[model samples]
Target: MPIISKQHGNTLLITLVILILFSILGLSLLSISISGMSKNEIREDNIQSQDLSEKGIDRITHQINSELTKKIEENNGLTRTNFINLLNSTVNKYKCTSGGSIADSNGKTGSYNACIKEVNPTFEKNKPTVENELRKSIVFESKGKSGDSTKILLTEIEIGAESAPETLKYAVGTNINDKDGIQDGEGNLYLHGGVSVKGDFKVDGNIITRNFGYAYLNGEQWIQSLLPESIPSDGSTNSKLVLGKDSYRLTTNTGYNNHIDRNTFTGSTYSRTTDMKNLFSGEKVPKIVQRDPVISPIGITDQKANFFLISGEYYSTGVNKIPISNVNKSSSKIIPTYTERTRECVRGFLICFEYKNVDTEKESGSFEMNGTNRFNQFSTIGSLELTNSNSTFTKGLYVGGNLQIGNNNTTYNSNNYSDITLDGPIYVKGNVNIQGANLKSNVLLYVEGEVKIQYSTINGKPLTDGKQGSLIIFSKGQIKISNNSVNQDNPSQIKGFFYSEQDLEIYGVGSNIRIEGGISARRIVLNAIRGRASDKLFTGATKINSNDYFEGEVGQKTRESRLQIIYDQEIIETFSNLKQPEPIIYKVEPPLVKERKI
Candidate 1:
């Protein structure tokens, strides 16, 4: 009976040991399960915090874009500082609530706080401080917080000019109506043969091109056409080529035909246009038109003249021969002979003057030269003619009527003897004719009428140090260059600005025409012809040409004349103060976001 009792006690002890082991195992499993749940909850909270931070960035972007759009719609201009203030205000409006918590539209609860850590505004290089509207970019470094997670987001915005028009910013701009390539079409702008523009190429009408032409705005190629269909807005179409409102198109045909080769474009053909406009505003379109620069006539008086050679009452019955020279002799009051002339014999030359007379109807003044005429100044009321003469003026020449340079007679082959030089400013109220005359000057030639430069070498002095003048030839009427006026010896070396209020025509068989400075005109026509009628296409008028033929060669001769217009930054900058189109901003790179742990 004792042995049986001991065995029962041992069995009871074994059962107690087994129950203790089971209890320990159950507690271990419970602890492990609780730890796993806690880890999952922590991970989920971290993910939500990151998402909140990203949301903060997106929210700020949307707010800023909306505010900018509103400002643009109001036509209110903003400076760099003003833009930054707007950004900061928008960011503060979308900040997290008091408890470091914010709720998204999806009912997801998280905490997010965003503040602009850094503000950077970019301005155009080499521009004046007053042109701060030409700011290139503005960057905002923002920090967002959600619980223990944080993120750093970089937002960049581009800025542009407000008063300038987009179309006028190009090297060539035309406001003429070009319907079916006629009407105001004579003034149409043309680009061809490796032409490069530093700025944009804006045209109110259609564009016509035959060779390759490239336009670079701020060192970037501009390839998109300004057609309505090319624009990003929903209501864009291919109707009117809106000035200051559309992109500049490049094509070989007048209407939208063979556009610039896509391979030549810098970015996607149509993408950059939308991207550029987006940088300005998401809602409202940018301004297009602006005032043009005013050009006034330079004033002159009789006190500035040396001698009044042509009296105001004198009328030309025929070609009058007037001998002008600096030579003066006390012995002879009458004009000396042309053969026995010496520089030491004269103190100064005679100057022609004609006052505004209404009573007497004077015939067009004509002059025939017997000898070399040197003068300090020359002025005329009626049309002044210089046929077969060697003339030189040191100070100025003001012609109230037409100033004919060479003989109009086709049979007149004395062009080699026609050498003219003017050192100072030349103001002509009528047309300027340079026919077969070798003219050279470092002067400002301003013409109120048409300018014809044909079969001559017209060299303008380049701007140099200590020389404060620029070779500016401005014409209120058309400027025609025919039969190789540019010196072939210096080929493509014509420097300075050549501007025309009317159309500019470059026709005739000549060497490669290279205009170095800037060419701004109402319209530009480029044609290659072997006859005179083709030259009249640009002049907008008909005049008797000595070399007229019954049937002339009129075919598109592209190889004979290759036109090149290279943009000169210095020259363009000098004229920046003139009225122009506003600039458009765009983003070059994407936004960058990085996660941070706190």
Candidate 2:
């Protein structure tokens, strides 16, 4: 009996061991299955999130582009409110909870909170969380949790071509480099609207901006503000515009106001005063002691007519001298002792005039003014020629489109109260003459073709008042401003002349450049015209200060008054520091994405 019991016990033990082994194998198989399922669900969720994020970006981009195009077409500037409204209108995000959901789609759900915050709305906010929200509606939120049986599905609907809403939607963000550092590549940046740069920046593409355009010297609040309110400490350490120092030049390697010997600088690089007048038409300066300050009053007659202007105030005397206020300054001083003196707006000057004879001027058509009653005026086309002839402008030439001039001696005239504003590019192909005492706005002179001045001059007569304004003359081709004829405005404000914010590009090797007026360009190609070199005897006596001169920083009160920075693709995609996850592409496209229910 004992032997039998022992054998039975052995058999039972073997059975128990076998059962334990099978249980272990079964558990392992179950674990593998669960892991595979979880991975599949995770992949699906990521695809949906990515799609939704892309859709959000698309909607935002469309709004930006549309707003910019409209602003340009209407000849108006863009505002922050405009951007915010567009964002809110384009995409409405609500919480996924039943109480928060709005326009919910599929089973995928989420929530959104208005991310618009306010700093100095006038200036570019520092990594503005609010602005970013408006620009990019989807802020990344991670998806992870404690152990549990949970599956999430996200759907995003991008406005793609042939897919419901036909919008050109492109995803832009940082891509991780194999070396780990993020690359600010163009591919990652998206340019939907016009972008401007207010600070000194190194870019990889052509930049275009309009109305109150300028580039700042640095990317800092204090630098942009130019006021102690931003940086209470010594403000002199801030970067200011230097003509020749700091190895600065109008164009790369091409010195500022330097003599071009072979389209390259030969003599010492200098910003000559004569070059200043040539680039910008105005009166000659008085030779004075270096660092001497001078202030001259401007004359004005009318009170009903309103006038505003932008001018430079030089605190120094003579040429190439630092400002007097900058003498013996620490590293934090804005500028050293002064060398030259220039100021604008001696008095408020208004531009207003009337022309009674219209039938004689417009023989072919009738044009309507925006505010005034119907009156016929002399046509500006082919009517006035400067063979030493007196020409008068009857009305303010307000431009809604571009103006192009052909090869011919055409005299452009404006009365003491008349002004000409090139809201768009003004292409001149022949010898063009301009005369006006009160220029309230700016003039764009682009000579893509030959331009010859028959002893013409831009002289600001009635020089008793020592005020002048600014001007810009740009030529992509041959140009010569050598006529003795005068072109000058009344001395009432510091005037800016021929200050192009764009890099000058010339194709022809025979292109010659000669300017008796102020000339500002991104670049200058003296050899664009091969034989035109000798013809280009750019002779003038005015000093040229290329690059926008820095004025410490404007206070918060003048944030919108100055040029604003452009948020181009490079700025968006290449912004320093902010890192985003790599775009997760999917094998199977996710379902259409919709805003979460509010």
The best candidate in terms of lDDT: 1
Lowest summed lDDT across 10 adjacent residues in model 1 is found at 224-233
lDDT of 2 by residue, 345-397 (tens): 21222111222222221211111111111111112221112222222212222
Q: Which runs in model 1 stand beyond 4 Å of their true positions?
A: 1-170, 176-183, 192-200, 212-319, 325-364, 368-376, 386-395, 407-417, 462-471, 485-492, 527-561, 570-598
Put down candidate 1 lDDT per residue, 44-108, tens digits, no spaces. Answer: 76667666666765665555566665764464334334554554454444434323223344434
- What is the number of backbone collisions in each predicted candidate, taken in the order shown? 12, 98
Q: Tell me how far candidate 1 lies from the true structure as C-alpha RMSD in angstroms.
A: 16.5
Q: Candidate 2 — which residues are off by over 4 angstroms?
A: 1-8, 28-32, 39-43, 63-430, 433-450, 453-469, 474-478, 481-598
lDDT of 2: 0.25
Best by TM-score: 1
